[model samples]
Structure formats: structure tokens, C-alpha cells
Target chain A: MTASSFAFEPWANTHQQRIEQVLSGVLPTDELLPERLHSAMRYAVLGGGKRVRALLCYAAAKLVGTDIIAADTPAAAVELIHAFSLVHDDMPCMDNDDLRRGKPSCHKQFDDATALLVGDALQSLAFEQIAASQAPQALIQVQVLAQATGSRGMCGGQSIDLQSTGQHLSLAALETMHQYKTGALIRAATMLGAYSAASTDHALLMTLDQYSRNMGLAFQVVDDILDATADTQTLGKTAGKDQAQDKSTYVSLLGITEARTLVRKLHDDTMQLLSSYDQAADPLRGIASFICERSF
Target chain B: MTASSFAFEPWANTHQQRIEQVLSGVLPTDELLPERLHSAMRYAVLGGGKRVRALLCYAAAKLVGTDIIAADTPAAAVELIHAFSLVHDDMPCMDNDDLRRGKPSCHKQFDDATALLVGDALQSLAFEQIAASQAPQALIQVQVLAQATGSRGMCGGQSIDLQSTGQHLSLAALETMHQYKTGALIRAATMLGAYSAASTDHALLMTLDQYSRNMGLAFQVVDDILDATADTQTLGKTAGKDQAQDKSTYVSLLGITEARTLVRKLHDDTMQLLSSYDQAADPLRGIASFICERSF
Candidate 1:
């Protein structure tokens, strides 16, 4: 099938289910030792989020002709990192959101201390999953994910955000923040997925990375758009939180119209970047389009 | 030198300086982007602690005839995990201590959010260091460290500690908690160190682990003793905070005399466990004795 003829829904749904299964298999059960921490970790990760990172991973793996099963570990690892970030970001000292994925935040459902440990445990579990993988490049996967998750990546972005709260940011500064905060992991997901295929070349990795960079930015711009326009019920999180906290976002810096324009550009760039590849890259294109067009 | 003749103080001082140097090199400086987070990470990890975990790792590596330079990565990695745990545990929601290693805690020195990010980033950095290692068994090291740090290990033990606060725990239950919390990582340190040696045998790993298990519990038993008997000036932390929090500790459960007795027993067991090994195990014995006899 051609890229345009590819059915994105089935692919997305299948990978989502696959990632959920893998995550469930890897995560400690409530029946395990330290039942409360295990339970809260499950509560935070098992039933929520769009699993977009996992989807990106699977799609990138498919581009390199990797079996869907081969993508499971990295996909699950990236998603765990995502879930841990959300849990910690919602804590009182951070964003302080009570709602996440239409449920009480981890700290709200469990106590703050349990939530803290849950996040910490999940972060380690993510690396553990990668380390335990049978893949030859598992160590590389760990390094990529770790670099993306640590100071120079997601955490760095959040720190910049925290420092910039209640202050205005230039367009460059805003993009820099989101690039580290969201874009780093988004790129990591695709990089990890692509790496799963042993035959994947350096050029393929670079192209996939560029595509993910644009897609990652598009994802954030769309998030800013939805956060400004959608209600809490529709968003499954505390909407307008950025504005409420006086946090500078795409919408705040460039207005909704300009934010939408940026998403369109990023979406176009992402699709064009993948155009050289065959139908195997269709899922990535579809996901990019979805990022640009999704309402909530 | 024979085990009995080993000069632990000078050896420890040298290794301590070595780990600090490695940590300083690995940690991002304040000059890096997201300057504050990098600064806080450096602050949280550098110039602090006994470096007991790194020492254990180096000693274990020595026992396997691994070069000290080869042990650097895993040694730094385990210590990074230790430092990260301290930063998080000292947060307001967990132990809520204002002091760590005789200085203001990370959260106190740089705000709670920075401290939280510092811990999270440090954990990732630890895994990154292991993943980036040139060691062939680096993946195994990652798995070992991640398992020891996750829900079934340090975090689990902390969760149990949080839940057991203000409630008495049986000596068995308390030992189980310490096994996970402290013993797991201590065991991991030796495992990682031993694994750095290409020829380290399973038998060697198992024996070293048993030694670390006793050494770890003895370390905590000593901690409890110090908390009960030493002043803030000596301990360099908030002495009596455990009692103030109504937390269950060895001193609280077994009393000072019994706690000291447990340390002595653990120390004896540790030394006996190493009796089969030659003088290369001297550092391990030295550390065990220090853990047993330390007033701070």
C-alpha cells in the first residue's frame, strides 16, 4: 500500500495494545513487595495517556523493517519515562495539577510521598526494561533514553520552564524549552525504535531524528493550542494551566493563529522528511498529521 | 599487604578523592545550559557523603583483579544513585531534613522543584554512565543498578519506611525493609564492581553479595546508633530526627545496646564471609569494620 492509502488507526491501535501489554508485563504488580508503591506505579502508567511516544517508536521501527515485537521494549521504556514525567510534573511543588488523564493525580490518588517514590521507581524501571532487553543495541538504547530524560533533555526543559514561569519568553526561548521538555523524548522514541532494527543505517537514524524533531515541536504547539482552547474535561488534564500559571507557551508567544501556523509548518516538514521512505513510513506521516489536527 | 595489615584510611581517602574527581568530570557544570539545574545536580552529588558505595565497588573490583580505572564507571554510577536518593529523601514530602552531609539539603539550597529535578536527573545520569561504559557487561550493570534502585529495591524500602512511620515493625520486617532499601544497592555495588572484571565468577559475586548484605545492615544499624547517641555536630545530619518523626529504627526497636550488638554480629559475619579471599578483600573488610565502629 502507498503511504496515502495506509490505515493509521489499526496500526496505532495495535501498537498501543502491544505497548500496554509490554508495560504491564514489565511493571511490578500490586501483589509484589511494597504493594502500595507498585500499585501507584501501575495507577500512574497502566491506563492513561495517548501512548504517542510508543506509537512513534513502533512507527520508526517499522520504517526500518523491524518486527513490531522488536519495538516493544524501547516503546514501553519511552512511555514509562513519559508517564513518570507527568506524575512528577503534576506534584504540588511542580505544576500542581489535581487532574491527569481524567483521573486524580498520583499525589492526589496516593499520598505525595508515595507519588514521589512512584515516579522515581518508574524512571528506574524504564531503564531496567531497556537493560533487560535481548537486543544487541540495548545499551545504546539506554544511553539515548537516559540522555534524553536527564538534565540536557526533559528535566532540563522543565527546569527552564520552572525558571521562566510568570515571565515572558522569546520565541526562540519557548522553542528551546519545549525542545528539551517534550522534543527530546519524542526524538528519543523514534531513535530507539529505529535502533531496534540492526540493519538501520546512520543516515536512516538521522532522517528519522529530523522528522521526529519537527513532529515533536508540532506536538507541543498543538498541545499549547489545545491547552488554551479546550476545557479540562475534553483535555483529560487541567486545561489552560499554562495561562493560569503565567507560563509562556506557543499560544502565549505567537497567539493561537500563529501557533496553528507553526504546527502546520512542522507537520509539513515532518511529512516531507519521511517522503523519501516507502509506505513503511506511512504511520509516522499519519501520526504527524494527527498531531497537527487533533483537537484534544 | 595482608587483610589484617591493610591501611584503610589512606586507601579510602584515595578512592574517595578518585570518585569525587570522576563525579566532577561526569556531572554537568553550572556553565552548561539550564545552568541552575546543572548547578543543583553538581551541588547534590559533588563534595558530599562517605562514598561508601563507590568504595565498595572499587574494593570488589580489586578482589577480581580489575584495574581501578576500569571500575570507575560503575563506581560513579552507584554513588550517583546514592546521591540521588539522598536528594529526594531529604525533600519536604519524604524525610524533610534540612541538612545533608552537614550542609543545607538540595531542596533547601535550591528550592524543592530544583531538588526534585536534580534527583530525577541524577538517576538518569547514573544509568547513562553505566550505559556509556566500555565494559562488555555494561548492560548487566545497568540491570543490576536499575533493579536495586527501583520499586523492589531502594524505592520500595522507602515506601515501606513511609508507611511504617509511627508504627512499630518487627525486627524481621525491619530487616526486610533495610535489605531492600540499603542492602540491595550495596549488593549491587559489589556486583557491578565484580562484573567489571572479565573473569569474575558467579561464586565470587554471591559471596561478595552476602558480605555486602551484612555490611549494609551493619551500616544502617550504625546509623541508628549514631542518631540515638551522637549529636548533630558529629553526625552532620539532623540527629534525633528519626525519633522526632516517630520513625522505626534499629535503636528504637532493639535499643542502643542491642543495635550495637547487631552491628557487631553483622560485622563479624561480613569479615568471616571474606576470610576465604586474600588481601584483595582487605578494603571490603576495612569498610565493614568502619561501618561497625563509626560513631558518625
Candidate 2:
């Protein structure tokens, strides 16, 4: 089937609205921060984007029959991590991108100094919000978020990406980088949703973890493909910028056709794992399909 | 007693050594991180000053009769926060000092980009280490550390300080900035130490909080004095840098004599608060005295 034949099911617009509300609620309201830092943070986070992390979290919680509101901390936490990464990634020393999500990057719209602090503040805020959360599962959720975003996770992945630039890497090296950088938090998003439901079944947690691993890798493979195929207008940011930087990507290493095939295989594998559960797993099934098929 | 006549007790050499050992143990092995990021982190963290924060954690834990080994996470966590702050504060947009603790600041030693990531990675690692800690008291310790280092704590204080630069700030505003910026972590150190000993008494925590608050401000007042009076060699970096930047400082705002008087009052008040705790609180007592009398 052609890509256009797949109907893009946007999962839970309500979840995105709720996450935006919570993010606005938790950010610093004090007047002490200059308008610049505040603006940079809001620009990075509140700017419209596909809130896929929050959606994944909400979808997973729903799959386990939990109230989606219970997933607020995890939802907000993932977005904060994502926002922080973007702020830093756009700095002149990193990707040096002048635009993001159809607007100026944090460092471009604001000064680099303000962008740096905004990233730092948002990151600290993410953990603080989780720790201060009143949810019954606050402590466990905080632990999950911290581990997923810290060294051996997101930051570790960034480190690998930074060092691997301009060098050829083995598939294993690339996968390891993605696992730490992207897969860790994606997996945490699913696990957080399950834990938000207060699920205690070890078996179910294990299966969701495996499903998340496949889906996370598949998500990155599709990202590489879109970078190759999408336009600036469609992608909402500069496309093919990755190639401009000579950075190694799944498409660069494996070719577009192979990357697409791998994503399909991973998508099928994830679906097979989710099949173990009954109707309670419907949301998970929907999210997996949405992730593979979504544009931009 | 005259400031010169007051005998200053040094940190217990063994306690200092133990903290050093713990810090070395918890940092990512050189092999795991990119050489640039890892080297910068090591240079910033191990390029030590007094290790006062770690000592405070160890001393507080000891006062409550908790094993020093159990204090490792809090000790490492506080140092990480301290290190990250120094790295950012030394950047071009902030205090902009090229040297820190008698060595080149991370940004000066490496490139600014690497320094930024080092600070970022260290901050993440701090939280990661606390969450992954195996100590029985890990959960409470993590909560305390997270709150202390987050917004409404250190980050918030920094935001205020940044905004207050070159602007005339009231004595109360100045106090508020120092309280948030420096006091939050200092208080966290004491609380972490107390909590490390498994003493969860609200009243005791309150008393230590009061003690730490006073001591933290007093420490900053002394820092202001040193900036005005000491030479670069003695101060181990640029002296009078604050006045040069026209940054709001206790000594600059209140004059040297008034700043000295405030430090003395804060020191006395801190000691009076700690009098109820007995010999176990000796480390705190010594630290309070040291704050008012230190030459640099």
C-alpha cells in the first residue's frame, strides 16, 4: 500500500491539550526570570508540535485501564526532556539550526546564553515536577524519568551522536546510540503509563518494554526516511540538514529502502508483542500504527 | 574574639579523603563518555575547592549517626550541582570568569561547547546516581537533592541573580537572591546529611534548615568581602570581579563594614541555632565559624 493510503490517526488531541495545560501550570511564573528565558522555554515547549511522547504515555495508561490524567507527570516530564534537548541541540555548537518546529530555534530567537539557561531550567524543572507530584505513583515515575533522561540514557545518546559525527559507524553502534538517546525515554514513556495505572504485573511490564523497544527504533528509522523525502514546508523545519552536517543516520548507513523495510519489520514485531494482551491493549496497537505512519 | 584570633578548624582530612574517593567512584569511567565530555567533567569536578558540600553531607549524616558510606549519593549529588553551577557561572554571559577553584574553568580549558555539555551531563548524572543509589535512604535523599537543586531552589536563585546584575537591588532583594542561589544547596547539604542518618523528625529538619539558611547567607557575605579585599592570587581567580561587572553584591550594596557586620550577625545566629544539638553538631559549628573568618 502507498503511504498516502494509510489514514493518519492522531491519537488523543485531548491528551495534547492536557499536557500543554500542565506544562503551563508548572513552569516558573515568578517575575525574576527575564522575559527572554521564559520566552525561550515557552517557545521550545508550547510551540505546536506532535506531542508524540505525551500521546504514547497517555495511550499506554489507557491500555492498562487507568485514568489518563494520572499520566500527567510522565507526560509533562517527557516533553520537558524533549524541549531541553531541542534547546541544546540548536545551540551554535551543536546542530546550529536556525529554525525548529516552523519557528526560530531557541538560540536564534533568544540569545545563546538565555537558550542555555532555559534548557538547564527546564531539565531541572522536569525532575522537580515529578518529585513534587501528588500522584500515588510519583516516586516511581520520577525514578523512571530520571533514569531515562540521564547518563546511560538520553544524555549518553547525545554524547555518542556528537562523537560519531563524520565517522562511519556499525549498525550495532548506531542501534546502541538510538537505544540510549531515543529508545530509553520512549520505553520509559510506555513504562510510565503502565506504572501510572498502578500495574504490578511483572510480565505485562516486560512485554510493553519489548514492544516499546521495537517501536522506538522504528520511529527513528521513519524519521531518517522523512528527512530524506520530506520538504522544508512539510517537515516544518529544514529537511536534509542531517546530510548537510555529514552526520551518520539510519538512511545514510542502510539506504532508504532498507531503512523502510526495517521499520516495517519492527512495526510488525511490536504488533505481535502487543497481541498477547486483549482489548485492553487496543490503545497501544493504535499508537504503534500511528507512529509508523505519521507524517512530520 | 577578633576574626584573626578565632581558630579555624579544617575539614577532617579523613572525611575529605573519603568524599574524594566517593566522587571518583561515582563519576562515569573515562572509557564510557566521549573523551571531550568526560575529560571536561573530570576537570571541572575533580579540580577541587574545599569539597565543603560533600563534607557537610558526610558530617550531617555522622551527626545523626548514619554511616558515612551511606552519605555517598547526597555527597556526589551536591558536588555535581555545585560543579554545574560553576561551569555555567564561568561562561561568557554569566560571571565570565576564566578560572575556577585555581584552575581554568571548563569552558576555558576545553571549548565553550564541550563545557556546556559537561555541565549538562554532570547535572543529569547527579540525578541518575541519586535515583539509582542502593542505600536504604536513597528515596528521601533523592527527593531532598532534587528539590534543592531545582527551580524555587538553586536555579530560581540563579535566575534572580542574573536579572539583578547591573541593576540596583535592595538589601532584601540581595538577600533573596543569595538565599535562592547559594542558600538552597547549602541547606540541601545539611538536610541531606541529617536525612542520611534516617532522622526524619520535622522539628530537627526545621532547626537545621534555619541553621543552614543563616550559614549560607553568611558564606555569601564573606565571598563578597573577599572579592573586594583579596588579590587575584589569594582569591585564586579575579578579585573585585563583581564590582567590575557592577553586579549587585552585599559588600558593594552595603559597604565593606556593613557586610562584615552582617556576616558576624549571621555567624552568631547560626551558632545559637545549633547550640541545642550538642557535640554531634561540631562539624556544623566549625563550618559556621569558618564562614566568617576564612581568608579566601
Candidate 3:
């Protein structure tokens, strides 16, 4: 089904409120931190946006029989990482966008220094929160999250993206970049949720890894399509900004039709993988669908 | 013994070589990673700095019964964190300095974007190296290192530093800034080393913590002194840059004489705490002295 056909309006409405409540409690309050840093963090995180990563963490945890309360740390952890990336991406040296989530980007609203510090602070806070969790497996989960977000993962991907500007990239090169930059943490989110429940099925973990890889790429492919087709207002940021910057995207590398087809194939593969699990995997299925169908 | 009399030259020389060697190996040459990212990570980390933090880690671990080779990950981790901080701190929005370690800062030598990515990459690499270590206690040590370097630690301190610039900070506020900015990782270095060796003594850890706190402030106090007394060539980076920017420092707040007295007091206190340990703690004592005596 197309994004328009899904009608997640009511579900999204409830999810947004749940995410807001969790974030407000999870994040250190202004009284506990520098007001400027706290405000910048809240600005990027609490501002209206799809809590896709958080949902993935919660869904994966629930699938593994972990309660939603137990999912809060990982959910907040991924969201913090997401917020940090956005803040840094919007810096003048990177995407240089003035806006994000329909509001002024961190660097634009505050000074670049504040924005940089905010990103740095949020990044550290993510790890701190994860490490400080009372969950029995919190340390292991935190370590996993760190690896997914660190050098061999997301940040490394960003480094590749920065250097890849104006350079021709093979499909393999593009995939490598996305795998490191975006896919790693997305995959880690699911893995973390499973690990949170102390799930120890090696076969299931491998299957989930494969499913996450497909979903991660599918997520990026859809993002590329939306960037090309969506309006700025609809996207809540500058649409086609990637094209404007001449950054290579899946849709640019392959035509929009091919990109869409690839996502469809990826979605199908992911669905097939999920079928091996029971009905408890419904949230994982829903998330994959949501990712494929997101409007912005 | 006085720092001038202690002779840290050999330690400095050996530690420098060790840090470079460890850094060179940490970033895998595997074709899986983008060449540009590998290059940026190398540029940001290799062949830079005095390796003070790395030396501290190695020394502390050695003191606690771990071999220097076994201490490599924590050593590399702290140095990488230091390198990342330097890279970002030199950005136009932060200290805006053009020179670092007597060479062009990363943002100046490479483009600002490359420098930013380099910093980001190095930060991730720090954790990656720690997490990937083969040490028996790798997981726990890595978690400790991450917490110390992240928010509520180094990054938090950086935010406070930026906020406190040009403001009249009280002695306690200044100490808090130093604790977060420089102290967190310094303390972590010692703790990581001890943790790596599986030292579970609560009293010993507390003593090391106290030693680290005093040494951390003493190091910063001496830094302020060196900035005032040393030249640019000798100090490596721009000397007196802090004073030039009207940043609040212990010397600025308490005068050089009082700052000197404070360092002496901290040094004595650190030594007293360590005295409870045996001669195996000589390196720790040496490090504490080295913090006070380093001309630069």
C-alpha cells in the first residue's frame, strides 16, 4: 500500500504523545544541564517529526516480549543519535540547511558553536543514558549501540558522504556509504531491542539482521524518492536539497522508477524474513511498512 | 620529586611512539571502508599531540598490573577523544585557532567539512577501538570510557566552557568546567586502566579518582601558567591564546601565585592518596608530577 493508503493518523497521534512523554522524562531537564544545551536538544528532538527509530526500537523489543517501559532507553538512545546527526548535518560545513523539522536548524536558531556543542552533548548523553539504564543487559546494549553509531558505522558513513560530494560513486560505493551512515544504527536499533529482552536465539538474531539490512536500505531509498518529489513544506525541510547539492542518492544513481522497484523488492524480502516469526512480529512488520510509505 | 627533576623525557618519547603505532593499526585498511574516511580518520588521529592522555592510560594500567600492550585500547581511546576535541575546538565557531601542535589545525589543513568529519570519525573510532579490544574486561572498560568522554563528562564540560567564555566564573564554576572538559577523560584514562586490569578495589578506585581529580586541575592550572609564560613555538599551539580571548582561568581568577599554590596543594593531595599504594604506583606518581612540570 502507498503511504497515503496506510492512514496511520490515529496510531501516529498516539505514538507521538507516547514518544513525547518518554522523551520528556528520559532527557535531563534544564535545571540539570546548561539551559542553552538543553533547549537545543529539546528543539531538535521534541520538535514535530516521525519517531521512526524509536518506534523501531519499541516494536522490536515488544516482538521479543520486552515491555514498552524496558524499551525507553534504547528508544531514547536512537532518537538522541538521530537528533545529533541532524544538528551536525545542518551545520554550514555539511548540508548547511537553515531549517529542520519545520523550524530553524540548531545552528541557525542558536549560533554554530551552540549547535556544535548541542550535538556533542546529545551524542554523549545518548551513551550516558544507555549506560546508566538499570536494565540487566544495559551495558551490552549500550556497547552495541556505540558500535553501530561509531567509526565502522554511522559516523564513518557521514565521513564517506562528506568526501563523496561531486565524486562519482558506484552502486557498491553508494551502498557502502548508506550501510555505514544510516543502515548500521537502524540495524542496531532492532538488535538492541532484541538484546534488551535478553533474547538469545542465534538464528533469530541473524534473521532480524537480514531483515533490518533490507529495511534500512528501503528506508533510504524511500527518503531519496521523497527528497526528489516532496515539497519543502511537506518535507519540513528543503526538498531536493540533495539534488541541489549534487549529492548522489539512490534515486539519482538509479532512476526514480528503479529506485522504487528496488525498495519494493527489499520490502518483500524483509516481509518474507519476518514471516518466520509469530504474530508478535506484527509491530516489526508495521514499522517496515511505515518506513517504506513515509511521506517525509 | 619536582617535575623538573623527575625526567619524563623517556616516558614522553616512548609514549609518543606507542600512540602513533596504536593509532595506525586501529583504523583498518580493509577495502570495506571508504578510502576518504580512512584517510580523514588517519589525518585526524595519527602523528599528533604529546600523547599525555594515552601516557596516563598506559601508566595507570601499568601501575595497576596490566602491561602496556594490554593497555593499548584505553590509551588509544583517550587519545582519540583528545584528538576529536582538538579538531572540533579548532573549528571557526569554537576556538577558531588556525594552528595546532605547531601545524595547521585539521580545519585549516583540510577543508572545514573534512575537519568536521575527521573529528566525527575520530570520535567514533575511539569507541570502536575500545569496544573491539580483545581484553577480557573490554566491555566494562569501554563503557566507562564512553561515559567519561560523553555528556555529563567531556562534552558537557565543553558546553559549559563555551557558555562561560568572557564571564566571571567563580572558583567552583571554573573547577566544574575543568572537571568536565579535561578532567572527565583524564579521570577515565586512569579508571579505564584500572578497570582493564580488573582492579575491583573500591578504596583503590576511590583513591585513583581523587588522584585524577587533583592531577586534572593541576594540569589545567599549569596549562594556564604555560600559556602566560611560554611562547607559541615552545607550547606548540598558540600560547597565551586563552588570556587573549579573556577566557576565565584559575590564574585569571586567583592570580598566578595562588594558582601555583593550588597546583602544589593538589599535587601533594594526589600523592598522599597514592602513598597508600606501593611502589607499583610510581608511574601514577610520575604522571602527577609530569602534569605539574610539563613546560608546554
Candidate 4:
């Protein structure tokens, strides 16, 4: 297929709907036991985001010649984790933020304690769902997901970010932080998708790891770019939050021009890794461009 | 073996040592990339409780003709989840306790944010360890553990508990709260031990679950009795905390004599369930008696 033939808007929208449905199906209903916690869990997950992680999961499934159905549970698992992290990070003791994705944060919408339980329960639910997958390597997939979200992965990233608050960090240090914090899960999302096809090829896994690393970092770089340039309404989150919180970001470390330049380089590197695949990898390429170029 | 031949003092001590060693081996060292998070995790898990959960795991393993070695990883995994829950529950927004296991709470020892990360990271690490288990039934073990720890299990219990704070609870409501909050994980600990041996016998699993629930409720009933009758120094935690917090308990709702009777009755029921097993279940019987009758 030619480059001009590839389209991402329709692809992303379709994946988002499917992902939302998958989440709704798996989450505990409010009519059942512990309705408030269930309600908050649903509230945190439903009615938001571009479902970029799910899209990546689907796109990676395509990379291995599988359909989106194969990626459904893993995709939802990754998003549940992402949503849980957001709920915790927005707590008053953490980021002290009141808004997330243009609405009240979980703690604000619910209560502090409910929000805390929401994160804890959601994390367990994600593992529970993934472990229930019929994929042959289900145990291995659980390990992969767990490792990415563990202390050496996402939680570790957030720890350093908290410790490094109000302190200037070198570019190497910042990269390491984001690598553990955000990049860990993004890479897991893509790898989980790739593994959802139950393929055991080590070489493809390595290539996908490289592809995911580049893509994950590129995603963050673009986010920093948007933070500096986009408005709150466009971003759907507090724009320029990094500057206000005195946290280091790509735009702050490097000027806007250099930050934008880094995004392009990472974007090219991501595409280069995906080029080994046929046009079936088009969604992967499309998402790379989409995430990097989106105004919000 | 005769009942008189069984002893819990040596058995529990040996299992505690073994569980501690496994925990140290699995937890990330503070020398690693995320030193603070690793440190907090270690601090939260090591040098902890009576290892009742680990003992239950080993006893359950014994029921299925497996030794403590077969039970090591699962035992440590349960303890880790237990430890993480305590850390989060001790935060200012939750129970706001200052001490756990006779030491400063995680938030007091570290900071609020570090405590949060410790809980988050420990939960992930627990899954990582269990998923790495070589047991034939590892996936189901994960599910059982996840469900026990999920919203409808531990977290759900905690949510209703937070909502019930300062409100009068009926005897049934209090029992329901403890069933989900404390009983769920206790039952999981025993079941994971059963599942650890990869046993497919439904009847035996059902028996063990019944034994666990009885033992779990009895354990809490004993706790409430102690809270009402013991001192902080002996309990290693604040005594009369529930009463002070306006939280209802078995002792608060049922009076001391009735609560004690309930504890004895539950203990009898637990023993009756274990009677169906051979002398191989002596350790289970011993632990149940010890939990219900221990001065501490």
C-alpha cells in the first residue's frame, strides 16, 4: 500500500470504541457488591482518552499478522494500568491536582480513600484480566506486564520524579526518569500486543522493543511539545503544567526548537524500526505520526 | 502422627525464617536504579508480622503433601500483598495510623509519597513473583490471589469500611466487612497453597476454603477481643483504635463475652473442617488454635 493510502483517524476511532466496550465488560458493575469502588473504577477508565495504548496494541497485533480481537484483553489491561496510575498521581499527596483529562480527578470526584482503593483495585483487576487470557504465554505476559509496572518500571519512575521535584536534572537523568516512568508501560503496551499473537520469535520481540522505546520516548517528547505550545482546551489537561510545577521536561531542558527536533528524530527512528514489516505495519507508522503531530 | 506429637512453635519459627529469606531474595535492592522505592518496599515487607499468612500457606501445602519449599514463593507473595495493603492503609487519608508492626508506618518512616510508591511497587512485585512460579496452576493462583485482593475482595471491604466509619454497623454488616477485608486474603493464602500443588480436586479445595473462612473470621474476632482487652505494647499497634475511630467491631457490636464465644465457635468449626484431613493437617489445626487463643 502507498503512504497516501494509510489513514489513522478512522483506525483510532474504531479501536477506541472497541477498547471502551472491552473495559466496560470487564469492570465490576455498580449494581453489584462494593458499588462505589466499582463506580470510581469505571469512572476513571471510561469516557476518555484517544486510547492510544489500545491503538498501539492493535497496531502491534497487525505487525504480527493478527487481528485486533487478539489484542483486546491486553489493550484493556494496559489502559486500566494507565488509568490507575493517573488516579494515584493526581491524589493530593502526590501531584495535588484537581483535574484529569478535563474532569475532576478520581480523588476529587470520589474521596481520597476511595481514589486510593480505586488505584489498588484497578491494578489487581488488570492483572486478573490478563492472567485470564487464553493466550498460550499468559504467564509470561503477566510477567512482562508486572515487570513494566513494578518498582524498576513505572513506579520507580514516579518515585524519582517525586524526589527530583524542585531540583534541576541533567538530560541523562531526565531520560532515565521518563524511561522508567512512562516509557516502561508504553513499551509494555506494544510488547503485550506483539505477544498477544503468541509468537515466540526473539528477534521480532527485540525489534519491537526497540520500536516501542523509540515510539514511547517520541510520544513523551511530543507531549512536552504540546504542553509548551497548546492551550488547556486543546490539550484537555492542564497545559504548561510542567513549567508551573517546576518539573523538567523536553521543552524546558531543550528549547522549543530542539524539543521539536528531538520529536522528529525519535519519530523517524520509530518508523525505521517498523519499516522491516509490510504495509500491515502502516497503523504503527500512522500512530507514530499521529501521536507526534496531534495538537493536543 | 498423634495430636500430642504436633508443635506449632518450631514450625512457625522455621516458616517465618524461610519466608523472610524468600522475600529478601525477590525484592529489588536499594542499590538499584530506584533506590528510594526499593528501600521503602524492603522496609515495608521485611521485619514484619507473625507470618500467619505464610504459615497458612505452608500448612495448606502440607495438606496436599508438599513441603514448605513448595510453598515459599506463594507464601512470600501473600505477605507482600499484605504488607503493601498495610502501607497504603496507614497513610494519612486512610486509617492515619503512625505505627505498624511496632515501627513507624511507611509514610512516617519514609514520606507520604514514598509510602505510596512502596505500596504500588510492592503490589506489582508480588504479581511478578507469583507469575514466575513454576507451579502447573500458576495462572489460577494469580486469579485467586487477584480476586481476593480486588475490589470485591480486599479493596471493596476497605471501601465499605471507610464509608461505615463513625456509623453504627449491625452484627451482619460487621461480619460482611471483615469477610471481604480480612477474610478474602486469608482465604486466598490457604487456597493458593492448595493450588500451589496443582491439585484439581474440587472437594478438597472446597474444604480448604471453608476451613480458611472460618479461620479468617475467628482470627479477626480474636483481634477485636485483643483490641478491647490488650495494651498497645502487647498488640504492637494501637489498642482500642476502632472504638476511638468510632468504627464498629465484633467486640463493639456483640460485647466481649459474645465475641469471645464467636471466636471459640469459629475455631471449633475450623478444626471440624480440618478433621476431614489426616494428621497431615495438624499444622493447620495448630495454627487455628494458636490464632484464636494467642495472648497477643
Candidate DockQ values, in order, are: 0.89, 0.44, 0.47, 0.86
Model 3 DockQ class = acceptable
Interface RMSD of 3: 2.7
lDDT (10s digit) by residue, model 3, range A1-296: 22233445565566667877888886667676566677777777785778887777777777678877788888888888888888988999888999899999999998898888777767767766766675766656766777777767887888888878888789999999999889998898888787778554777678777878888899888999999998999989999888887989998899888988888888777777887676677677778877876632
- Interface root-mean-square deviation of model 1 in angstroms is 0.6
What share of the reference contacts survives in each candidate?
0.87, 0.28, 0.47, 0.86
Which residue pairs collide in model 4, if any? none
Model 4 Cα RMSD, Å? 1.5
lDDT of 4 by residue, A149-268 (tens): 989899999999998988999999999999999999999998888888766578878887888898778878888888888899887777888889898888889988888888888777
**Per-residue alpha-carbon lDDT of candidate 2 for residues A1-296, written as tens digits (9 for 90 to 100):** 11233233544566677888988887765453444466667778894787888888887787667776688887888889888888887888777889889998888887777777878878887777766665656667767877777667777787778888889889989999899889988888888887886654778778878888887898888888899889998988889977987878899999988888887788778777876576667667777877787532
Among these predictions, the greatest lDDT belongs to 1
Please, what are the lDDT tens digits per residue for candidate 1 over residues B1-296?
34668999999999999999999999988999899999999999999789999999999999888999889999999999999999999999999999999999999999999999999999999999988885878988999999999999999999998999899999999999999999899899988998898767878878887887787788788888888888998888988888898888989888888887777788777777888888888998888888788842
Which portions of model 3 miss their true places by more than 4 Å? A1-16, A134-140, B1-12, B30-32, B134-140
| Better structure of 3 and 4 per TM-score | 4
TM-score of 2: 0.92
Candidate 4 is scored at a TM of 0.98
Task: Look at candidate 1 and give me any clashing residue pairs.
Answer: none
Question: By DockQ, highest first, what's the ranking?
Answer: 1, 4, 3, 2
**lDDT tens digits, residue span A1-296, model 1:** 34678888888788778888899998988998899999999999998778999999998998888988889999999999999999999999999889999999999999899989999999999999888885878988999999999999999999999999999999999989989999999999999998898767889888998988888888888889999998999999988888888988889888888888888777777777777788888998888877788833
Q: lDDT tens string, model 3, B1-296?
A: 32334456786687779779888888655364656656656776777677878878877776677777888888888888888888899999899999888888888887787777667667766765665565666666656776676656777788888888889899999888888888888888888877777555777677777877777888889998889888999988998888888899888988888878888888778877776666667677888877876632
Question: Among the candidates, what TM-score does chain A have in each?
Answer: 0.97, 0.92, 0.93, 0.96
